[model samples]
Target: MYFDIAYYFRVLRHVWSLKQWPGKRGMLFRLLLVVPLVSAFHALCFLLDYVFFPRLWRQTVERPVFIIGHARSGTTLAHRLLAADGNQFSYFLYWELFFPSLLQKKLIRALGRLDALLGSPCLTRLQRWDDKTFGPTRHIHHMSLWNAEEDQFVMRAAFVTQQWALDVPMMDKIDLFHLDQMSDKKRRRWLHHYRECVKRQLLLNGGERTHLSKNPLMCGWVAALQETFPDARFVVMLRNPNECIPSTLRLLELSWKGRGWQPEQYRESLRVMTEISFESIRHPREVLAGHDQAVFVDYRKLVAEPRDTVHEVYAALGLTVSPSFDAYLRAQQDRERNHQSRFTYNIDDYAVSVDDIEGELSELFDEYQWPRLSRRSDLVKSVGP
Candidate 1:
């Protein structure tokens, strides 16, 4: 059934008020509409929850797994591979953002299946809920759908609570980090709920011994993750920082998008990412040293010899190599492959010498001995820029 009459009227009022606002075009539209809509949505959820079926709200966590690395670090690919075990179920698209005590959970899952068959499920430019490869999952929020760990829900909490203008710049800033000035107690509350949201996925899935997941944002929060689940294993994917820097710049560029950015934000994000990615790798290595729980994999190795690499990971995790898993691997074998992002960035694009950008990652690149494009250029020049 459609919502109550008051709900319909409220929505109409929201839409009509939206048409009147002069500042609705830019950040203003989101600032105004997102607040009340999200607020109403959240309230409607709690109101219907428990009082209704209460079962969907009470499911226990089934299994817990995680995929952790910086953005664009092949974490998405890993999510696909690990989650491919057909025996182990994952939350589908619609259940992502949808919170309906019970009516919606059953309703949404049914619709998601139908939507997948009827046509495409691509919801936002960022991702799709449909059955296509080469895409990340987002948009739909349901209790049933497994989600890559995202701050969007948490950040949405802040948005609804404070209406802290989620314009393009703020999003870029939030992308970098969100709990900048909150007190320790408040920050802990944010983190607690964040993990709770993740734990809920394990509840929705079969709650197996192994809970598989991946999130690019988790890199910065490695310590927090270790604090929460000491047994949690992290697989950090590494690429040459010189290549990583440009790829990170591109990812940020994708987010800033239409808004004009201060040249400094791009440079700063690059510089910050360079530091954080390496720190994310090193600090966890140092902290989790004796634990032997965290593993680092090379992206090139993953794409080239996926079977061997995946086998290595499974072996390390102590998973009994099942024949069913082998079939799963074959199915995923020739799937959407990696697109090496290094070639996407030309030396001329940044208006800075490769050496200059390479300088930020000097410590990491040198330690890992991944050659610089500058060094490669010199090698080419000696032989035949």
Candidate 2:
């Protein structure tokens, strides 16, 4: 009952103010009071952040490093492991997931100072000091830690909405692939917006040489990406569709519950997400034709031996193994000790049958060594909590 109520409210929060809710704008207008209030809060945050924190310029230079694979394929685990090298560039744990950079760039140092002054750095329990994050996520827009994270960028920028995200539309019209036919003029514009955003991140963090980012959108645009970043390396995490789909469905269900209020209302969205499940197998070989650095790391393997797997990943990405990297890796493990406690879910409702799972992920199962389960037992010991 509690889950149901919480889920409904979440959906309301997501859909209430968006395109679906009609009277929401009126509330937003009435909440103009919040603008000034938040502005003051933001400005005060700015003064504090600017004063205390070292002003960083993002080190988001185009590098051949990446942590990828299909959805739920240890990308987060891998990205977090590689992130430990202070030299390997990445957004800080707080900033990457919470993209509040526009203001942070100018005032994050001061914000920290202010927080210390208050004896409240204002860290949320939600702000895990160490957690693995995977995304081409960058800080582009706000300064509030409440900003939406990376996948939103994929959904909106890639133009892969609920309806046609997986339908294989004309290559030119597809979001990521669309870049292929973009007039040199238009393509550069998108790249510029993207690059500048990344550059801002690099500017904020100094001495970072390699830019390793991850995104599931790359599942379909292997050729175009290789061409764009000719020196770019790939690390596609392979997960069986059976496991990946149910996990993805659960995630989408959670998101929908948080934002839209009713699952029935989001039928199309649920369907879109369901089809996106098989995305990995639909275009696998194209992901890594002959790039030596292009690796397909098994999530299960990494889950079993995280440190060793991470080390292998760094070596594959051509990054040097350093004590600093190991330190960061250790710190991340400590953070994970408590992550599961914060999440609540109903797994019974999420029951994904073996047949349905196989039907969806058959391609990935046949291609990769990802385990296939006839019942949930085969996956029970499959690893990676």
Candidate 3:
């Protein structure tokens, strides 16, 4: 979440690389306003990090657990369950990603104190706003102010994530599938920036807790991550590609709307992300194929039986599931069950064909034994949102 001066400059440089503005004048105007405000905030954050948290910049990360998967594949709930083990795990919160500076942290603490003193609903309002804006498909992916979120935000800040395309439409041209192909010096620099962001979170959590990170976008960076944290454990979530692809398209459509973009503007981005998503699975498979450090969880099993799935995950990772953590997992299951209507996904809504999608993902389905829903009705019956 910490966007330093380097990060801002990287974004600007990427935008400049395009050499052309988006066709729409209004969109261009809005981008003009957004660029400066966001860059100013990031510059201020860089000043805060440099001036106040030198110790955090030096903190070392060790053996963190990563939750990886394609978009909407249950990584969020999985991360949430793992983070429930308060004694063993700590993660970056959604709000922390936005206000990552030491100064912002103090400001957040002051706001919390003020809320408590005045019996205000500031936190509640923020959660509601997040649910409405980011969690359009709340059942599929619910983002909140306090929930443990994907580290992609941090990666974006370091200019190492494909998510930058969402903000700067020109970035859709970047080939995110080949991050491992980056020059060693450039890759190392990006890794250092990424690690510093994680280190800040570790230092915030008192430097003793094991970091637990979830980022579907990181699936493609598996090789690099392995090189950086040799002992870190990985959990890969697998979902039926026939369902995952269209669901991802829907999410991208919503995101594009935020930028005042039309459907065509996002078609290229969608295709690239989908192609990258398939290639991403190959990374962990190649890196941790026979290694005990990696665990693969089926998405259907996770949603159908979260508690049992979580227990198996903990066992696979060689971590004990504390009674408190188990209780929290079960409670989360009940809550999700009651909110089932929130998770609705329909393949028919997207432009992709069932047969085409299945063919594209044939290797994945064959490898994972994921059922291929060939017909529209079958897809509708298989999943809700």
Using lDDT as the measure, the top candidate is 3
lDDT of 1 by residue, 134-190 (tens): 333221111223544332243343331211212222332333232323346544655
By lDDT, is 2 or 3 better? 3
Off by over 4 Å in 1: 1-26, 46-63, 89-103, 112-167, 171-183, 207-210, 259-283, 334-343, 351-367, 375-385
Per-residue lDDT tens digits of candidate 3, residues 1-385? Answer: 3333454555555565553456344444544576467656755775777568777656779888999887767787788778878899878888787655556666787989999787769877876887687775555566677778876575554345555567655435565556577777656666666776777778777878888999877776787888888888999988877766677777677767876677666677776766676676566677778978889998877777889888898888888888888888878786655545444457776667677777866787788888787555687633432
Alpha carbon lDDT of each predicted model:
0.50, 0.50, 0.71
lDDT score, residue 157, model 1? 34
True-structure Cα RMSD, model 3 = 3.8
Residue pairs that clash (backbone atoms under 3 angstroms), model 3: 343-384, 343-385, 344-384, 344-385, 345-384, 345-385
RMSD of each: 8.4, 9.7, 3.8
The true-versus-predicted C-alpha distance at residue 317 of model 3, in Å, is 1.7
Better of 1 and 2 by lDDT: 2
In model 3, what lDDT does residue 6 have?
51
Question: Which regions in candidate 2 have their CA more than 4 angstroms from the true location?
Answer: 1-60, 92-104, 117-188, 221-224, 327-353, 360-363, 376-385
TM-score, per-candidate, Cα-based: 0.68, 0.64, 0.83
